[model samples]
Target: MTQVTIYTQNNCPPCTFVKNYLTAHHIAFEERNIANPTYRNEMIAHDAFATPFILLNDEPMYQVDMDKLNQTLGL
Candidate 1:
């Protein structure tokens, strides 16, 4: 199974959208909210300075990147 991790923040619409999209597709994922210092630092280390940073098997996406998301998840 593919491993998906999402770095998100509180009260972010795009973050919610991405989470919902993944859920709707039944794509299991690990959500790391940036509210925690560790997760925030991790996101920055990965060069993701925004909310809804997604990682699929360690590959990073800074935004929704619908094409890449669909292709990666085989949706």
Candidate 2:
């Protein structure tokens, strides 16, 4: 099984969009909220400077390129 993780900040519309898209597709993902200090540090450790930083199978994806994401997931 491929592990998917998304690092997000609070009240972010794009973050909500991504989560909704994933949920709608029945794609499971682990979300790290950057609003929390611990998760923020975690995101920073990954050198992520933006909200909704997605990790697909441990590979970092910094933007909401849905087509690429879909291809990566083989959807």
Candidate 3:
């Protein structure tokens, strides 16, 4: 089950890092790209205005923040 959501945009290195980190850890996640107008608003609504904004169990954060995210996900 996916407990992670990452909001990203094209050519953002941090976004790629977040995705690659998740993949490396075998963590499942839903990707929401801000390139989509709808998703841009969603990310802002969640108080994440940057690429690689991450949500773990509905808690908002930016970038990987593995320790915090893993804590939330009970990883």
lDDT of all predictions: 0.93, 0.89, 0.82
lDDT, candidate 1, 1-75, per-residue tens: 889999999999999999999999999999999999999999999988998999999998887899989988899
Maximum-TM-score candidate = 1
Worst 10 residues of 2 by lDDT: 1-10
In angstroms, give how far residue 35 of model 3 lies from its true place: 0.6
The most accurate candidate by lDDT is 1
Better of 1 and 3 by lDDT: 1
Total backbone collisions, model 2: 0
> Which of 1 and 2 is the better model by TM-score?
1
Ranking by TM-score: 1, 2, 3
Instruction: Give the TM-score comparing model 3 with the true structure, all chains together.
Output: 0.84
Name every residue pair that clashes in candidate 2. Answer: none
Cα lDDT tens digits for candidate 2, 1-75: 668999998899999999999999899999999878998888888888998999899988878898989998878
Estimate the TM-score of every prediction: 0.96, 0.91, 0.84
- Candidate 3: lDDT over CA atoms? 0.82
Residue lDDT tens for model 3, 1-75:
547888999999988987887788788999998889999999989877778888777877865677886666666
Residue 43 in candidate 3, Cα distance off native in Å? 0.5
Ranking by lDDT: 1, 2, 3
Q: What's the true lDDT of residue 68 in model 2?
A: 88
